[model samples]
Target: MTADHAPVRGEATGGLFSGTHAPATVSFAAVMFLTGFAALAVVPTLPSAAQDLDGVSLYPLVAGCFVAASLLGGVLGGHWADRAGAHRPLAAGMVLAVVTLLVSAASTSIWHLAAGRFLDGLAGGMVAVSVNAAIGQAYPDRLRPRVLALMSACWVVPSLVGPPLAGLVTEWWSWRAVFFGLAGITVLPAVAVAVVLRGPSWGVVPAPSGEGAPRPALVVATAVSLGAALGQYGVSGWDLRHLLCTAGALVLVTAFASRLLPPGTWRAERGLPATVLLRGLGSGVFFTLEAYVPLLLITERDAPPVVIGLAFTGAAVAWAGSSWVQGRLLERSPRHRLVAAGAIVQAAAVVLAIAGTLPATPAYTAASAMVVAAVGMGMFAPSLTVLSLTHSPPGRQGHASSAMQTTQNLGQIAVLGFSSALFNVFLGGGAADAVGYGAAFGLLLAPCVLAALLAARARSV
Candidate 1:
């Protein structure tokens, strides 16, 4: 069905607010922030959870599964948003999250925890895609970028609150209490979204003349992208060594997603294409560096878990600070400039982390450098993202959102997957572990450099 066949609203309906409805903008932003908050809140308690549940290796599985499930959710949610409209999926998603947290907190086995996480991941995926789509459909072209920034900022909050909040809570009470705390906190916002999202007035029915028809190209691309994710996981897990698998997955996903993306996106020529490319570059390089930083500190530097967590926190804090600053100045800069600067900052951070591999440098020195790099990335994010959202055609806005998100996630999966594989190459022997991890870090440095180059070119082309 094309946009012409869909219903279009003649006048603006007052949404959740009293005068001109903000179209649940606040609700969407709140939901996103809460999602980030939940992620942080859960991690600190996860280990304590393991101890409470008879020491299962389910810790990694629980968190990993949630992330894995999100990949599924992000894809399906895009299509679902196309069909059912955003409100239903968005509302249903929140409810799903609530239910999952309850079950996760009450779990006795790893499977239960995993199941809850999967369900929650599913919901998060739905909320992210649907809300994103709604923002595209409901708002005028200009507001879209601002909304995307608001939405993206949702992930930033967890970095700030997730670690310490979880730390203090777990120390004072059982880790399980943290889950309960999250549950209690969610109720208020969930209810607010539910209330604000009510009535047909607040809803966004895909426009008849708009671009939201579900495309077969997207389904194929998502399938290929998802398969690629699985293949990358195999590589990361060391179960598969066929560079063919990783390479094949990347090619397939690239081809499929290209069809779903705008005309110039495959080549990443300029304008919105550049923005998409920056999103990929910034996220991939930033995360690839992040993935190994912990392992480096723990093994080579002999840092404790708390120290490792803090190092992670330092980068996250930097990330959050950047996000806050960028959001505050949403109207001032061109998107491409932000992307270019962010890319450079991110690459510099990777270089610093790379240098830290020398066994002699103070761990905090490397950590602090990474945090500084994150601040640069923060500058890059909202602008690059806002540019994409504002530029996307209404009919294809949902696809754009998914495409950008897919690129970011795929970046992490691919670059970090490679990082994981290389780290495992030297797993057992102490000497090998040091050398291997360093080599892996060394291998990825070029991409960050290349990404910076690409981001710089984003504006010109």
Candidate 2:
């Protein structure tokens, strides 16, 4: 570690809200809350927007564009942070976020809306990476967990309110109103954060100098992002064209995605590699469940939309609560143990979801799957992040953070795509709907188990 890169221990004497850390902490938290609100709110409006634009067939492309663009954004933000400081990227991301919202609000066509979403994703990815890098640079090791937990908590209110509020606006007015409202509400706070971050105190630690940090390959990142988006669009339907697109996507990701990650990440090498891999595994399990569980309930169990909404709200609350426990009560626990326990808990949740696919099982059983999985993620996600930062070399925390972000997006794309393929195969084989759902949920167990087995690899040496 360089002299300036030394850990800033015991400097947070007055805590996160105290004199020194208050401005940056509040600014970051506020930005997170707004970003969460925009993300959760905008998703529910996309379907309505597509319908209004007469481009319903292209909805998957529109939806997937954000994730694709985020891959590029993560690399860009991480590189910028390492080369400069996290504060600049953070401010730039917030500004771009507001601009994207306005762009969406004025959209006259589906492609325009897709462009806005892609820009939003880019901004979101930058903000996410920069925030993690900032935390690594600004906070001490001891305070990082709490900061992460607080970041998780920022999502709780957004998850509870964003979707329903968007629904109401769409019902009473137009879907575009949501974008305009978000932009109007976000602009001032975004500016405030930008100004606050410019202060000398924020990102006080200078970036690591010399040849320790290597720049990420932007071309490969672009391919992976494009591949991920195409993969998502391909899976929306079953056709020869879609299959070919999916095949091409697989080739793109398989060929170049590994170059962006730490060495041995695929094999879960001990230390940082394992930590990054664990992020993917745990995220894959949770996201697959989140995507499928609600669909299962609505399609098979005849559950109401209100029921589904409440389930989402409950899951967010559970995640926040569990994150709180890990950050405070279990603050001293070994992170590897927490990760292992979380994986086991997630595996149990997957089992419950699978059981809910049975004819005799009640609808609530499946709806609860997301809440349970969230509890596990609450423990698993932050611990992996802490481990990644802890294991990172002096000047490479940005690289590690970017790799974690990249793998997380890849995990979502890969796991969800695979599960969707399995579900389609069962349906095409003339199996019953329950059978298809069962097969999909059944596939999730493997990753959860593997995460448990590899948790120890992430332990500090």
Candidate 3:
């Protein structure tokens, strides 16, 4: 069967693997790596940026601006690509990202850093959509799950390491070095794309129908994501006002998203509705638990940072490996079993997390809980992604992908925000010094419950 997007076989040109990567695969990975670079690398160095700016006060603005801009970029990039073409948008965005990295490295003031981060994030958003859409078009159906899983793994590996390396550069050399280093790392991906995927086979974007109203929903999702992100940087300067802002942000986000999705989806009707819900719930529970477990180990259980880092490493690697394995293993499984088992495993991990907390030893408890959470998350994410894409129509892949990501962004905000408030209510001022360390860990159940509910809906779907 001929593909609507690719009229010619790219095999005639430089293949993704010329030796290793097929042209499409290589190009897709290149884009995914860029997305990972921004998501993972720049975040940890914000403190150094704050220090370099010579005032701690500007830190919140620095982080928020980057996130806000990225949100906007995601909307623009997706919409523009749909109107223009993926190849040009991705190519131009990469160049822009590279230039911004240089600007980030050379920044002399907070404003400069903010500008650079914002630009960098903008490029990141473009990369996320184009690369993902490319993968959807390029890979065979049987291989798509693995390809997406690989993309997820690339994100996980770099995201885990980018922060620490950013911190190290800031500590030993300068935060600027992290930016410069990222700039240098980008060359490979950019070069690969230019060399390997430069043929006529890849299609530009199709024009939007009518006014493209679905895009507004993505913007709202970004606001929701921004609200959740704001909570993490609160140590720099966030409070009740920020929290309240997030609440309002989420309402708008939800309302907007409701419009973009297929009718009755927000309510999780059969088929695609349930798929979107699964995407949201899978991510929501995983991160809600993730955000707090380390703190529990360090403060409540009194484990050291090194041990905590190891616990995280375990979760990350496990997640990555599971994503890879599922790519190979689940090709034959019914979407129903694959999706349902992934959900059940992830929920079961939350139960395991509860059990881990029951143990008194911080080291043992943290390790056990993290392993469970990581494995569960690993199983859930890629599988859910596959099911979501599986049911999407060819032309609607962009809309569906955006909807999935949009749901995830909202999930992070709504589930995480609600969980934080729950944590404060359950374990407050005692956690003022403690940061709600242990009680925060308990919020894993919310997402698990949500996921289970969605999984049931998925079965019927």
Candidate 4:
């Protein structure tokens, strides 16, 4: 089909695994699974890697590098997909992923490991945007949600096994083994992804002229990525240098980041703009909670590592299950309404988390917050993705997907920074630990509320 005349729904008959869709579907899922496994597995090994390299003081920077690099990756991948096709970027990202794994495996210094992580994040961002763009180009509107849900499902087994497996490897062998092993296992899958993308079934839709122009978007994305890294590092401490870093980050983002998003995104203009805004808000709320909740359980309640790990597992499972429900049972529901409902559910989860900060509440109450928030995300996140694709002008799905990824990263950085500030302020003011925790959790409600209020604007007029 021509760009302007692209079909709203795909012409494929039957389910994802049936007939012509099977190869692309299976290949994409395998890519996601490997990606998910590497992500989950690598995280648990960071502390050991940092300590062994004698970079304990710079741990936050090491961890934050991946997120920073992903912003650039997203923009690059999106533009590449728009100009060429999703397949090329997707295949390139897979290859880059393997290369990054090898880089990390061979790291001899803390900075080397950080560089590897940044490269991996870049690869991840490319892969993520390419997959979403592929879905938009290849699948019809009716099938998008299910495809997204299946992608979510691909992460489940990885979530269940990755960390523990990495932990065992780290404990039994060395942290490097995790990287080497991930690289070894993913090589074939990466090749498979490349081979699959070579097939003609993936609908290689390139954006029309003037629609997917790159120019300043890539530059803006780079600045925003740097700002995010600075902001994350800034919030790791409350020193004067960190404070100045934080201020600088805000300035950078405020100045250039909007150029990368839809016009009036900050104002939550109806349709695509609001959809992008909601992605940020919803993501901010969930990531903020995800970061702080485990810290609360560990420090305040003295919860064991096992308990924290289980909470993460539960959250992953809940996210997958909820995504399945939205894609399967509620497939006919309006996307905007589902988004609003999800926001409301997320608000409730935040409240539960706040309540858990009290001395009288059991520790599990706080831990359950992660799962609850994930449940909300399962519904909210995919609905937004579907809506974004639906509302995107024909041939511009890559641009839309890029905007969503950009804002999602910004949301995490902004929300986490604000909540961290609140937590630090309360603690510095001599408040009890519970009060500080309460303040941080309470700050998350604003985004949840804003997202709920603006959810309707995401609907296509």
Candidate 5:
């Protein structure tokens, strides 16, 4: 088929898993499943690992470091994908994951665990951006939505199985066993995928390297990582030096963030920039609110672990179903309208969360709110991705993918950090824990509203 006449979802000709691309599609799905499983399975074990390594005080760093390091990884991955092809970086990221898991598996100290997580995040970030860029390059425009939806669906099985399996492994054997087992299982499949997808016809052609000019992208990427790390450290401590660290982090972010995003991204310029900004805004609110879900349920409502688990599982299913809905509507509906509608749903979810704080509210009220909000995430996340890929000019898809991922990381950190700080302040001030939860959810409503308002800008005018 010619590039001008491409196959789309629901076509009589073929689906996403058909033709010469079938092997690559299957390989991509396999690796995605592995990565998703690893990502979720490891989370529930982190508390045990932290206590074992005496890193309980620095527990937040474990997750924060991953987000911080992923920024650099995303930048490097995008540059490498553009300069060479997505295959090399994707393979490297997979290998890097194996190595990092080994490090975590062998860790005897808190710093070692942190180092492993940081490297794992870096590798995972690279893998994610490269996969997005690769999909954009490999698939026809019409099929992109279906492919992205498929990627989201890959998380469903992981969400269902990872936590319980990890808990069982941790209880029966050891946390290290989980890491070692994942690393061992991922190696052969990752290597197999790399070998299968090494052909030049995969559609990712290398861009010309500029003649001896300094790599501005690299500089900006490094600055973002440093800023995130410094910011994390500042939040971890309460001393004077921590305050200085916060100042330094802010300076780095202010100075370098713009260099990484689209020119008018800071101003929410229409089209690509607005698309990227909306991704950040939507992700920021959802993730920040997600972090507090378990806390509110456990502390305020006395929900059990099984109930908490059920809430997350339901959200995962809802997210997948919503993604499927968007894919089916790709031809019938416009992206901007879907995004705006999704954002409104997100806002409504927040309101439900706030309402859940009432003493008379049902026990599942907060959980229901989270699941519904995830539907909003499901609707818009893939749509924005498709927009980001389509809006980019030719070889710059890698850069566009990197920008989206970077903003996502930054959004999670910044919004969650701010909301967490607010929650802590309220708690310290002797406010009831329920009051703190309410205040934090109230604060989250602003970004959700902003994201909805900006969704129109994601469309081509």
Candidate 6:
């Protein structure tokens, strides 16, 4: 439906925060900012935390556990939102986030840290899915792009300041303080969301799916989590047992993943399913490649940590800028074309990143590539999200939004896992670390190119 036809109050105002949604908007943005701040703040500390805990070998687990656990949270949260509005799950998710932060704050071992991260992921995943579903339900089509763009923009201040402040905190005091600080900061937003989201303006009629998680989806969510955990473990080890575990994980993931996504998602079935596929592909390639950016810059180029942090800050700004541009253009431009353009830019950035691996390449080359790639992701992500909401029927917005989250997470895990395994294989074969990094980056090219090819299929019918 066009702006004139949408069933919402803010079409004539052109202001995302106008009318009934202002309170909810503030609450959502606050939550996003807190999470964004905490994420950037804590990421740099994890390696140190792992080292101090003597769990350096489990570093990948610390990262993967969150994403793995999020799958369950996403599916379960979606089901809950569909069954009983978004208020309860969202409130519960926020509370869980606070608890998880405390858990991480007090951790004395790597296992404890991993457990904290896993629970954090669960809470975070639920909060993310619930918020997206809320947005889908709350805003009309005319406002969705702008609203989602605003969501992206919420990362701006956090991205700019979080890392440096976190560095100071880690230097002056303890890493545990960061977690405690974030937990404390989160309480305000949690309370505000619970209060503001209870009004009639935020009410959503429950979907027809009964009042609980679907048994099959819950089962699939469990399989996906297990598969992800096993996959991460499998790639980290080298024995025959590891190989067997890898094979089993793949089998389970392959068998059950189809149930979690829309039918024909694998084939890029036209319309909503294809949009979903593109979201996964774009996210998968970029994030998988992104994980190595700091490592390569610090290890290969000997770039200073400050420069590395600034590079990420620059990328965040670019992402928000691109999202704002897309929001402005949504009325005049077709989403598929925008997605295609973004995908092509992302692919080029990936190639540039690989070139930056050369010893003679400029120190800023990798940073530039990362920044440009962020622009592409920023442009496409909200567009696809808007499409997901517009395409689904009345009651299934939760399902569609949940599927998007699931696919994005799965994409990250699958691509990162495969590239990690390849990186290890190259290292085992005596390739230089630089060469392994290059090969790993090269592995991402396939999905990037495919995403560009399939972008047109994401067009709404």
Please write out the lDDT profile of model 1 over residues 1-461, one tens digit for every residue. Answer: 35433322223434333254453767877888887788667877787777777745445556555655565566666666666556777778787888888988898887777778778877777777677777766665445445565565667658766878887988998777877788888887788887876766444454357454456544674465455544554564433444665566667665665554456764667666766766766676677666677767877777667676677677776776676666666456555666666767776776677777777777765565568667877777666656665665544555566656656666666677767766766664455565776767776666656666666445522
TM-scores for every candidate against the unseen true structure:
0.81, 0.97, 0.83, 0.96, 0.94, 0.93
Better of 3 and 5 by TM-score: 5
- lDDT score for candidate 6 against the true structure: 0.82
TM value for model 2: 0.97
Q: Which segments of model 3 are wrong by more than 4 Å? A: 1-21, 55-70, 156-161, 204-240, 352-359, 427-435, 456-461
TM-score of 6: 0.93
Give all candidates' CA lDDT scores: 0.66, 0.88, 0.64, 0.89, 0.84, 0.82
Tens-place lDDT per residue, model 3, 47-139, is 877787885776766765564455456566655555554666677778888888999889888888878887886777666666655655555
TM-score of 4: 0.96
lDDT of 6 by residue, 41-114 (tens): 88868887888899998897896788888887888887777767777778889989999999999999999999
In the predicted model 5, the residue pairs found to clash are: none
Please report, as a residue range, the 10-residue window in candidate 3 with the lowest summed lDDT. 7-16
Better of 3 and 6 by lDDT: 6
Q: How far is candidate 6 from the true structure (C-alpha RMSD, Å)?
A: 2.9
Q: How does residue 133 of candidate 2 score in lDDT?
A: 86
Superposed model 4: Cα runs more than 4 Å off: 1-9, 200-217
